[model samples]
Target: MGTAALVTGASSGIGRATACRLAAHGATVALLARQAEALEQVCREIRSAGGDAFVVCADLVDAVGAEQAVAQVIDRAGRLDMLINCAGAAHLSSFADDAPSQWQCMIDTNLSGTLNVSHAALSYLAAAARSDRGTADLVTVGFTAGRQSGPVTSVYAATKQAITAWSEGLRRELAPSGVRVGLIQPGLVDTPLARRLGAGPGQGLNAAVVADAIVYVVTRPAGVAVAELVVRAVGR
Candidate 1:
């Protein structure tokens, strides 16, 4: 079977760059996100570059939708060797300042969304791990905010922190299964999310730079597990 990978939030930013990078490395990539038109555009770009890609448009915040999206990827891609969880939301606000809706948005998208997709893809990833590939990767796109909290981004930071802890536990749990679960903790990237949070050029890493970190994580030889990588801009 050919190597197949699934990437969430592939419509833009780090997710988009990761999907393209994985495809350029010859993995059949399934791009997942809530944006149909945007995902289709990504798919077109991948195909034009002689890479195989397909779009799976589903809201990751909904458990059922996330499961269906994973199923769709397996159905079309034949197998899933890598699952990259990049579907997340970032809302910078004080805990007391946010309305209930805003807090829920961060919790549901950043925290629960990542869980739902990872849970749905676990068995498939494990099965792939047992295949001739002999290894599988389950990656979460985390942030430095997860390691150190910011005052205004209380809720957002909490969500990232949760994912970091969850990824660690998952790494231990899936270790024997030959599934290498890892997290990419980047300091600041020039993603749509970071721009919305006021990150200026030359102040943070580029989205593709983080994507390169992800590619590095997934491409290590078998039995070599990079549990977590901290990517930060120079002199920061």
Candidate 2:
């Protein structure tokens, strides 16, 4: 079977870049995100570049919707070879001043969202490992904040920690099934989330850098698993 990859948060930033990278590598990519217009634009970009892609606009926090979205990707692509969880939310502020709403938003979008989609795609990924590719991949984008929690990153750090923890467990559980589960920790990426933190347009590593790291992780030989990676800009 040909390669088929589903990338969450594909509307912008790292997600969008990753989807395009996977598509360019000959994977039939399914771009999943909450924004229909942005996703359609990415879809058009991919098709115009002679790459295969489709859009699946759905909130990953919604379990049923996530399941249906995964189904749509598989139905459209015929199989699922890779799943990249790049959808995320960040509320950067001191814990003393952070609101519950911010906390909830980060948890829902970062942790729960990844869980919902990975849970939905587990079986299909396992099956894909048995296909001609001989392996399947699950990748979650994490952050360095998860390791060094600072004053303004308390809650965001917690969610990323949870993601890495969950991904580690999943790696162990899926290893026997020929499924490679991995995590990417990108430090100071110049994304929408970073712009919210007041980063300039060209500051930090571009989203495409992390996208390249993701492609490297997923494209390794079946017997070699790149379980964890940390990508930082040259001067970062």
lDDT of 1 by residue, 1-236 (tens): 26999999999989999999999999999999998999999999999999999999999889999999999999998899999988888878887788999889989998889999999999999999999999999999988988988779778888999999999999999999999999999887888888887877656888889899999999999899999999998888
TM-score of each: 0.97, 0.98
**Which regions in candidate 1 have their CA more than 4 angstroms from the true location?**
none
- Whose TM-score is greatest here? 2
- State candidate 2's TM-score: 0.98
What are the per-residue Cα lDDT tens digits for candidate 2 across 28-80? Answer: 99999999999999999999999999999899889999999999998898999
User: Residue 118, candidate 2: how far off, in angstroms?
Assistant: 0.2
C-alpha lDDT of residue 224 in model 2: 96
Best by lDDT: 2
lDDT of 1 at 26: 96
Model 2 / residue 169 / CA error / Å: 0.8
